[model samples]
Target: MNKPNQETLDELKAIYVQKIKAEFPKQLKNFSDKNAKEHQLSQLRGYLHKLVGSGESFGYTDITHTARAAESIATSLMSESTKDKPSRLTYLVKLLEKLAGIVDKIEIESPVTLHSGANFTDRQSNAKLLTVGQAHIAKTERKHTICVWVIDDDESVAAQLSEQLLSFGFDVAYFLSCAAFKQALLSSQPHFVIADVRLEDNSDFYRCADLHRIDLKSFGLIIMSAFDDFHARIKAVRSGAITYLQKPINVARVASFIHEHKNKIQLHPERILIIDDDTDLSALYKSQLEAAGMAVHNLSDPRKVMAAIQEYQPDLVLIDLYMPDFSGMELAAVIRQFDNFTSLPIVYISSETDNQRQSKAIATGGADEFITKPVSADILITALRTRVKRARQLNALISKDSLTGLLKHSAIKEAVKSEIARTSRDRQSLCISMLDIDRFKRVNDTYGHAVGDTVIESLANLLTQRVRQTDHVGRYGGEEFMLVMPGCDAESAQVILDDIRERFSNIEFTVGNKGFHCTVSAGFVQLEASVFLPTADSLVEHADSALYEAKNTGRNRVVQSITARI
Candidate 1:
């Protein structure tokens, strides 16, 4: 997921602080006037609930604890508040003052963010949450095109469907008879099959008996029939067709069906961050995470929290509950001061074995998990897996673009920077590809932004299908995209990107009855660790210059950057 930059995070954090400050006094006055009324007291509890949840996340730990306490007091006094106005008023006023002070503290301590921590289960679920798995994390990868073979008896209908499917970026082949399709199946397996119920020889292609004879489980099957009744649907279902469409298949529906299946084929590995002052413990966690096929980073000094965040950008942060200079809760609070890091999952790892005390710390720290020290490696892995998985799933919603699932600008930049440094240190190969849709404005001007978006989406999907899972792809902004290829050389990267460029250009995009194709230009820089490449920014700049070279040479090509200083 694309992580927001420091400046953007700071701006968002400031905005949130101001909003809370502005709402505090208005709500405080409303509560004060109706202190003795049960309904009004209930309303006051709502405000307290907000403070309890968000206050600590933004580093206002005191407000969170105080609001929690005040909520309990308010709840207890709800029934007797009429006879206890003086006491209710006194307690409520104190809470309001405390809330106001927290706002002041937030504004002054904006830059004093510490480190975000982890997620913890509720106190009752701590034992269950810690039950780990011995199984190591497995590495995931990516694949190729959505090759669909179409079988239908109608010639015009078959041609029309093929044209539309191709326009939507699918590789489609139309065959009039089942015999021909069966022959083609022997040569190459199609990812999908769109077959008609009837054939020229009057054979039932979707008959249950026929389905069992053919290896129907090998591919996604969609059957089309003029008869759109329950009987046809049930027979199609029994015949092993996953999708049953009527005579005239909606081209858009078929495209969406194919696109969703393509997405299901993509996978990304998990990344975890460990924040423990204990070098030994941090190393242990690192070893476990790595064994499970996860990328891990460790930080001993809490002072470099923000720098670590900018560089690491982990899915989950493992925080030690106890630290001498800075407490675990303090670090978690500091990380939360930045709005962007607020949602970051933090799990507390410490030697504190007392269940009540650990639970209290977990609750107060706003952590996602609380694991006792001397815990098994399996338990740690299980806890991190469950919590981090959820965090990443949620992160994608905010970090990825609506059109392409690629990381947005800031996040992708962060990813590229980290990978460049990693590959440089390990003496590995790294390539940065900056690609742009050639004459994108012309597409929008001629067709429309909506169609232009389809072109961009097509290119994004093609790139994902073409690259390895270890690589990163992001919509760097506008028509351009940035691809970070680790363990990939300039020549190999060029070959892969050129393949995507050719495929993207060949995809016949449709606008109503008319169809047009779009092309892409890419410039990538290979930073061979042994060859002494420049800074990350320099690499990107060089790639950009090379991209211009490609555009000048006539778009729809890939160019490798010169090793010499530009």
Candidate 2:
């Protein structure tokens, strides 16, 4: 096999190290069982053989040679001829540990500048000349388009609805018949569907129910019904429609419903921000909501409420009624002024349940609903679902960047911060990294932003593909990304990130007749309970510092912060 370049070699070594660290302990634990021991020996031997073949190619000859020796001993133990089998297993385990230690000492080199790589520079040069609009056009082409199903039998209704939805920047499929809709649903697997309850026949309702049973993972469903009776609406709800809207369908209301529930359909977990001056109340709400699997952000500062909201960009904002100077009503009104938050649902949580006070709270454009204090978990969640769904609908209008399907910069920051807080409180190890496409400005300066945007999106897709399911990767800013790896330590995190770098370097991107590739630089820090227990800022700073070191050292590598000796 051909040898990997120095960069690739380092990355592979990191992966090998992580695999050894994670697998060795479990392998040892199984040693007590005779059958399990033998089975593990076989598995270890196979792994060693592969490692020997690949490790030398990545220039880790010493580690590979040791693994091969370990493999031989384990193989001998399995055959029962080796009298020192227990000792051999012990030796093998120690050798693997030694190999892991060697890998831990290897440092990731900095990424080469975008233009320095043979493929990346070409794309950069071509991205330089395009106008802003033209660049957006190119980016639009590269985005992963989500399909939406609009299932209304009325042609005029469907068309009007489709137009409204498409304006919000979604790819839409319109179906007039339930049969046609079901057929399309199989292939499209839309992110969400807007459907009418009354189909051509009663069988359509059964079909809808059937669809839910079969594709429980399908994006959220919003049903429109002509029935004014409460029982029929209740039936629709029971049948699994997240919400049932009564006709005549108001376009604005339908749009709102779609916006709020769209994310629910896609199963993006709800993010709830609780703003209360009382620490005990905040903790109470936070614990209850987290127990329900909803992400919560708690802020005790009434003065910094806006800043918290902007930072958290929560799906639902729960505020205490009374505060020192800025009351919940006042805060809601202030939030409503921002175009991005115009329809954001702000629910008041207070002791005052009097109709007059409730009416006053509701009068604030930002306050969507009021839940009296000492709110039960059930009522709170119901209010949250209502508000969050509505916020999602409002988000459809303003939150997403049309090109990448990533939350705009403002929203992404809040989401990252919330994730940081959640992971910290849960005591899970988290890896946060900042990724920058090396010399992105040069790419934009050379190829025109059109091609530049393509490269950016391609990188985003690669990051998304490479990370674990629990990880969150978002476009942080222009040409930069913020990634969160939950349940990963520094060593394990580096391995995953290095693999991403290696795979990304090999990807082929094109602009017209021109072909190109790009490399990314990342800096990451692990969240350990003892070090970064309460604050999100420290973790971010650590990662940022590491990223800076990576950029300075060279660009395509992962750097981690070194804690100072006390």
Candidate 3:
């Protein structure tokens, strides 16, 4: 787990310290009245519990320990079984007095201490821009250089895996032992490590331990073994292996897994919505999450939550359990009522320490998790990242085409609509390309549907590989595909699509002992906000018409839309 900026964190901590100083004494004074003590003890306990959580999170060890002790006493007094209430009350007051003294002694560091680490916010923003053609080609070119290191005692296994990864555009290095890998780590770091479980020295289980001791940062570990024993699997999990593969590996599967994992981890930004009545606390959270590269929106008013969700379209919702108008559970229930947000992740962040209340909130509101306040920044980021990644995966399953893994027809149309709106606002150029496999039905009739399916998949792969990451590709219908390229002018798009047409024609398809080549015909419509008012339907219709002309003129060629030609 990574942390946000140290200076911002220090500022937030200082604010929290001042907050404790201003509020604790007033809260503790309520305990002095015997009649009010019974009524106010619960409130006091809640306050102290908050201190205990936030203090530890902000590195205030003394405050956390003291508050924990005072909270325990308060909880005991509230219970019906407590008999020596006066004695416990006296002890609680002394602890509270000690806490006040500790707060007075606390000093915030003035000068900032900067830590050199990757900027999460920049990475997230780049991911969003990648979808809109804002990031340049260099970024995509750099992705080709992802380094993967393989450690296997078997020379043949290492060589085979390394060669496969290299063919997939990964930089690959292989070593026979952990020692060699460790030695290589002195110079450069690899993005991923594929290690064998059975090392020559039988120190396989300690490989991950060695990496941890050396403090390796930001790399994935994969463990492979010939033995599928339960103990081996357990050790792999204990060693923090991200994935485990058995012997007789599918090289293609490994390559696909790496590509999928890399794209999923690197390309998505976490969108978070925070609803809390305490404006200061919400601001602190907003700053922290944003600094960590998440797009965050915070609201002090729960009444506007639905509208915010609609506009922001968050990946996860973080709600404070106690609010002025509606509790976190109540808001979650309202969100769950809508079918669109039913599967959205809703997490409760609060200082309430009662186990029963937390459980009740989760069950009643259909919340995913109940996170107690005072969570470390690293833990918070990691937890939210895991949830967001899972949610995105689920979304892809629902919206992506099964065969080609591109957006489905409806999803891509919706994407075009959204992109068109964005282009209109930004005053940018957008291109929509419609592609059809030439004589695709004839091929199915001659070679069978399976071969035709292969042709479609091949074209999908080619288009996806050739296009920019910011572009969207979809299976529009049988034998047809659609591409939405933002910030791309007509001339550039024409050349790119022509290049794809040439490449697709060169790919040889085989059926039994026969081998043949297939060609694709494509037509594209480019829209400049200054020249034309582009709607999604018109873009699709014009592109399709151009595609129809291309098919009529020549079976394999790229054509610009007639509307754009004029």
For residues 187-216, write the lDDT of model 2, one tens digit per residue: 445666778776655546546547644453
Off by over 4 Å in 2: 1-265, 269-367, 370-386, 393-428, 462-476, 531-542, 548-555, 564-566
Tens digit of per-residue lDDT, candidate 1, span 1-566:
22223443353345456667777777777765443577777877766655554454445578777887777677677766377667767876787787678676765436433222322113212432232221111111232346777888888989888876665445678998877876676566677888888878777885532654568867888888888789889977876778798765655456656666653332344677777765434644554565565668878898887778866778888887766478788888888888768898888876555699887877777787887655655777788888977787787887898778889988888777778777756778888989999999999999888877777877776666567767889998889999999888877897888777776776766566677778899998887776554666788898899999999998988888886222
- lDDT of residue 139 for candidate 3: 38
lDDT of each: 0.71, 0.64, 0.76
Q: Candidate 3: global Cα-lDDT? A: 0.76
Q: Which candidate achieves the best lDDT against the true structure? A: 3
Listed in order, each prediction's TM-score against the native is 0.52, 0.37, 0.62
Better of 1 and 2 by lDDT: 1
Per-residue lDDT tens digits for candidate 3, residues 167-204, read 44456789887777777776666767888877776665
Best by TM-score: 3
Q: Is candidate 1 or 3 superior in TM-score?
A: 3
TM-score of 3: 0.62
- Among all windows of ten consecutive residues in candidate 2, which has the lowest summed lDDT? 1-10
| Candidate 1 Cα outliers beyond 4 Å, as residue runs | 1-266, 269-355, 361-366, 370-386, 530-533, 564-566
TM-score of 1: 0.52
What are the root-mean-square deviations of the candidates from the true structure over C-alphas? Answer: 17.1, 25.8, 8.8
